[model samples]
Target: MNTLIKQFTLFVVLTLFTGMAAVAQQSDYQIQQDFRTEYNELLERIDQATTTEALEEIEEAINDLEDEYEQHADLIDASSNPDSFDGAISTLRQTHASAVESISTIEDLNDQIEDLETEMEGVKSRLDQLSDERTTLQQQIDASTENEARQASLIRQYRENIEERNLFVSNFLGELLSKYQSMDSAQQQEISEAAGRLEENPIDVIKNVINEYINMMDQSSALMAPDYVSMKAQHGYFVEVWDSIGEQLVNTFAPENPAQTQEEVDQLLTAWQSSITNNLWGSIRTSFSENGVELAEFNSSEEFFNALNSYLDGSIETSVERNSEEDYDVYREFNNFWSNTVKAEWGEMFIEGDILSQSQISAIDMKLDDWRDEAMPTSNLTFILLIVSIAVIIGLIVLLLTRKSGESKA
Candidate 1:
């Protein structure tokens, strides 16, 4: 009876051990299934993630799963059938990494775009200030009397403001161009939409810049004492800006008609040149008349130069007859008008502004030199007359002395 009790106890013990083993095996299988289910869910989340925050959350979950299943990894892999647990883990890690990279790129692009928008706002503000200041300075110039020093000072400030504004524009454009070239089509479209929200489209900004430059040119043309040096410098800067950014702007906004845009710009520049030329000619004509040099109506610069040459010829002929101090004063006045007013002011401006050629200026200078040589008072004739009179007086004294001596001797 004791032997029978020992066998039953052994059977019961064996049964308990068997049951525990089965339960533990089932538990491991359950853990493996749970791991796969959670990993697949995280993968789905990664696929659906749109933003950096979402991607980060997914990456954290993936790392957590890796840590939780680290010890059971071997078991999970052993139990896995068609799709290996190791493969799924690798896929989740790789997919999560890819999603994070993509999200980071997008976020970086957005940050850059925001920075550009902020910069654009500052640029706009600065440009507005410059415009206001220029207008005020122009008003001051117009309202003030004809004080050359004050006018020159105001004009210098105006030009400095213009240069500052243009430099800002150029720097902004360079940054924008770099960003634009780096972007893909979708990114470029996004930027374009952002620019629209700001109500300052890049193309429109370029157009406004061109318009402002033209308006400034018009104002210069209307000014009584136009700053030709400033105008030429500004024009050159405008050309450089246009060359750098013009094509890109057209490509971004009006890709279909680049040639038309170029043609329009050309026409505007030509018009500006014509307006300045006409105004300068009108001023020259008025100045000539004020100086008592009557010039007929001239159709072109060539015709005006011809009339000028004729006047110089007539003046040179008259210069030879100048003998008195009053005559010298007249010559000095004409010479001062030519040197100070015409050559120093207008002629230099004409050459610098490309209104006249160097050769033409050289010809005019030669004629002026000839006129000066002939008009300047000389002592040669007076000295000759004085020497002849002295010789005649000495001869008469000698004759009287000789006649007295002869009479005394008789």
Candidate 2:
């Protein structure tokens, strides 16, 4: 029994030594079996590391139980006090707590570093966005600059057009001023007033005003057409009367002077208008009164009437005055009586001779002198105004469209 007790005590000593080896190897199960034997040694060594560096190193060693703890976070939690290394583990808790307090002071600084890195990523993203914005802005600016160039070109064209139109204004205004000087001063003032309420183009307005005057004069010139018509009617009356008289006289007096060719007679008749208007005032008055009316008065000589009457009786004496509008009063009286009388005489001659068939003579058309000269016309100003107004409206719309596009980009 004594030998057995000695053997058992030896076995216990060996087991204790083996447990010490396991403790060095960080074996929790082995350390548990013989903790009583190794506990004092662990405590002595733990106190030996008293300096801060030595404590810190020991704390590193203990806290660097990182690998072990990682494998057993739940097993080694503060509430996970293992019965095997309870006292040693308890001693380590105090040291680790002190280290934790020191590390807590650096936590805010470390978090700040992480936040700064995150903010840098955000800043990079914003920088990228800014770069894109800058590129888009550059494109917009380039387009706007091109538009400015186009607008500048338009301005240059406008200035050039202004210069060109000034020439028209120069002539129109000069003529108008000269005309105005001759007119009543009140008339001139009225014209100036008429020019005031205008904007588009003053030169064009002046030109349009002059064109209106010219057109008005052209329209009024139609009234002179009556003189031509009356003269023409008298021409017809003289032609029918003289042709009949000449054919009868020639046939009776000179039967062998066979009817002249159509061409020769046409030539002879062509000269009649100039002939009689120049002469034959008395005969014309007699013929006109016989038809229906009378001449107003005789400003012309009897020689004039004789020459014309002699021509109607088949004599051609070309010596005659060129009666101008200076002779208007004399001609006007003759024309006033002849206007009705000659037309009536020509109608009677047509009825008696039946030179032209009724259908042909009756179909003869009479047109107003306005066809030859208009009374009032559709004005050119209206068309020009329409074109200019459309251009201005289109230009304004394009400008507005470009502005809206630019504003949206901004």
Residue-by-residue lDDT tens digits, candidate 2, 1-410: 99999999999999999999977656553333334334344445456653445555666565544333445433334333443344455566674556555444345434534553454344435434533443444344445555876645544443333233334334434443443334444433333333323232222332243332232223221112222233334346435544434333233223344265333444555654444343334444455556443435442434423333342222111111322333333334434443454445444443333322344333321111111112112243357679999999999999999999999999
Candidate 1 per-residue lDDT over residues 204-322, each given as its tens digit: 56556667666876775234423433354345555665666566555555556767876777566566556545555666677777777666676466877787788778777877776
Output the lDDT of residue 343, model 2: 41
User: What global local distance difference test value does model 1 have?
Assistant: 0.70
Please report, in order, the local distance difference test score of every candidate based on alpha carbons. Answer: 0.70, 0.42
TM-score of every model versus the real structure = 0.64, 0.18
Candidate that scores best on TM-score = 1
- Provide the RMSD of all predictions against the true structure, rounded to 1 decimal: 10.6, 45.2
Residue pairs in clash, model 2: 280-304, 280-305, 281-305
